[model samples]
Target: MDRFELFHLGWDDLWASQLAESSHAGRLGRISRVERGECDVLIEMGRVRAQSDSQRAQSAVAPVTGDWVTVTENDDGESMIEMVLERRTELVRRDPGERETQQPLSANVDVVFLVHGFDRPFRAGKLERFLVLAWNAGATPVVVLTKSDLARSEQRNELPAVVAAVAPGVEVVVSSIESREGLDRIEELLTPHRTGTMLGESGAGKSSLVNALLNTEVQETQEVRRSDAKGRHTTITRDLLVLPGSGILIDTPGIRAVGLWDAQDALENVFSDILDTAADCKFRDCAHDAEPACAVRDAVEDDRIDFRRLERFRAMAAELHESEQRVIERDRSSRSGRSHNGGKRRR
Candidate 1:
């Protein structure tokens, strides 16, 4: 296979120049999986396990799955990562309850599948929160409603409308791995060389979906408890799986809490339609509360928008803004501490 073909460069030619900055003079490899301090990389030569050396360590750059990196071999036959290429996209989330750090989920992804189970009715606020992170990752968000077969017949009928209310223009698919329904549609999105990440709460059928796509029991699946309907976390670490026929998929462990950090743009984009409607309001910064001539409130009153959905959006937006402020405050304190220590050392 040619270098481009072996490296899975389908439409990512723009990244070629950025990937050439390594010590190897641009010999590139794709990161398939990362564990602790090492990674499994796929290059033109084939799959090789490698780690970052001291020079790359100085940069504090952590390589996640799907990242293209430059690799070199030592006399001892150990390959080391010299540098990481600029990512086209990166999925990041605020460390849960810790506003000090950003957790990178994946890099260079083309799409994100926000999975949710029908056993528990979809929560508009939670969906909005996930979408914020997805949009911030620079990947298109597609909502996947899993476990459709578990829903009551009447409840299943209302699924489409519920999805439509929360996310407009975002593709929503109802899937049931047992019945194999909607698998083809999901497969179509996994075009060759494209990468996607799965995001959802624990037991939302993410693993089951991966198993279905691979057509094997690659990922373990367990039944949700009848009493609580919660799934056990079968996937302990994030693993990247290459589809036999097409693109790659990053399977992440179940996320219990998805805190937001610096996602103001994403939140605004998610609520753009409502913001557009609010432009006609009397005040420039209308809160959409009981303000006079409030277009958003009027729309809610006239049944143009669901009141619950609007309320959820407002609450999530506020929560994300608050979280961002906390992160900024934490950074300021850290900088102050560093400056104080430096002055003491000089004295």
Candidate 2:
């Protein structure tokens, strides 16, 4: 394979420019998988194992699957990742635990499948959060409702309409691995050279969907709890695989919590109906809760919109506000500490 053809792996002129500063002898490759600062990169020559210095990788940026990086050979002839090219797009969420930081999930993605299963209770609020996360990543968000075979006919029919209401301007595809449904639509989204990732909770049939797409049992699958329909964490690591004759796909570990990180604009975009309704309220800052002349409340009262969805939208708005405040406080504290340390040094 020619070196230039390597660009088919989501590389572009932007990446080429970013790599120009690095050693001219380095080869460009996309990270297929990353584990403990070690990477499996796909280059023009094929797959190669490259080691990334943990300290340096952390200092620059931890490599994630789908990241295009430049690899160089050391004196020992071992491949080492020298630099991570700038990502055209990346999915990031609030860091898990007590830290107020952003955790990048994947980079340079074109489409994001926000998978949810009918086997479990479908929470519009949670799905809205996932949509915001995908939109915030600068990638097109497509809602994938899986396990359709488990749902009754009425539910199976209504679920798509309900999801479509919440996710305006986004595609909602239903899939049932048991019956081989919606696989074609999924394949349609995976255009050549385009990179996509699946983000969903456990038991959402992400692994099963990928397996169906590849026409092979490449990813392991497990059954969810019989009583609750909650699935165990099957895919623990994020892996990027190239489709046999199509685009690249990345399957990520199930995320238990969906936290919003600087996604205010995305929140507005997701709940645009509510925002538009709120605009007609008498009070400019109507909370839409028992406030007189509130168009949003009126719509709910008149059954123009589902009350549950309106409530969920309000809750997400509150969460976004709180997240923004926390980020502000954290930044202020960091600046204060820096100023104090600088003063001590002057003394």
Candidate 3:
């Protein structure tokens, strides 16, 4: 194994220790792209196609791009992913097809770029949801507003402040491929040995940003529709690329359906002002809706919190509660079915 590739790909002693403890006797490789039945894994010998039967492996989820896995050869001499090392961080969202299932987007992600374009109206709900996703993954989130050349002068000066209000304490960088504004700031966020990925809907200029960061036009670029400013899905799969003299970057397909899974603490992080104000509420479990002595409501009246933002937070919290209830019910039913298979124990 070349020592440089390990560190270059963000592998360290922690991952080394995990590989040492694995029962499978094979080398470590990172999954660059996950296909239907196979994965493109980067090993010392370079990228190779390996069959994946790892959905039931130790990780218990199908390996996604950026997962460091153990690759072993089978009796037929075909490389197989025997196990996926315990992940350090994972970008996850609820499966669009399954109600209660979680879909792991990327494994071991260090930074998540929440890309948006100035061509379209700013969507705070989408930004908040993406923030929750990044926070839940234990990754730093950066709001990258692209197409600076096209933004009106007011948007250039005033839009960033508006975005800053939505993403408090998160870095917001305005970038343009033509003008090359704020590109250096975005590049500096990813130091060597870190892995970052971008998330946004179609026509958000995510791939263009990736091309800029890579210093070459590797990703295909497209123009958005004039009427709606919506772009087609140009980038289809997720692939990891090492930046020149910098860190590793994983580019993913446009994510239009960003269904949040289990993200209570992350949601709190997104609306930290609300969380802090709720701390002073008269009741510990105050819902802040018409509740007497509600510090949150008081703050809204005092202009400390925007009423619309408060309403959005309330709606998201209610949705999260519903999701929790569904999870508990599903777990109880699964347990009941298991007990019927001769392992029944009466309380």
User: Which candidate ranks first by lDDT, i.e. highest?
Assistant: 3
Candidate 3, residue 342: lDDT: 52
Residue by residue across 317-339, what tens digits does model 3's lDDT show? 88788888998999999988887
Cα error, candidate 3, residue 205 (Å): 0.8
Q: Write the per-residue lDDT of candidate 1 for residues 204-259, one digit (tens) a residue.
A: 99989998898999888788878877878878667777776777788888887787
Model 2 TM = 0.91
Q: How much lDDT does candidate 3 score?
A: 0.87
Alpha-carbon TM-score of each model against the true structure = 0.88, 0.91, 0.93
RMSD vs true structure, all candidates:
2.9, 2.6, 2.7
Which residues of candidate 3, in runs, are more than 4 Å off?
1-4, 54-59, 341-347
**CA error at residue 122 for candidate 2, angstroms:** 1.3
Candidate 1 has its poorest 10 consecutive residues by lDDT at 1-10
Residue 172 in candidate 1, Cα distance off native in Å: 1.1
lDDT tens digits, residues 249-346, model 2? Answer: 89888887777888888888998888898899999989998678999988888888789888887787887788888879999999999999999999
Question: How many residue pairs collide in each prediction?
Answer: 0, 0, 0
Answer with 2 or 3, whichever has the higher lDDT: 3
Indicate the residue-level lDDT of 229 in model 2: 86
Clashing pairs in 3: none
lDDT of prediction 1: 0.80
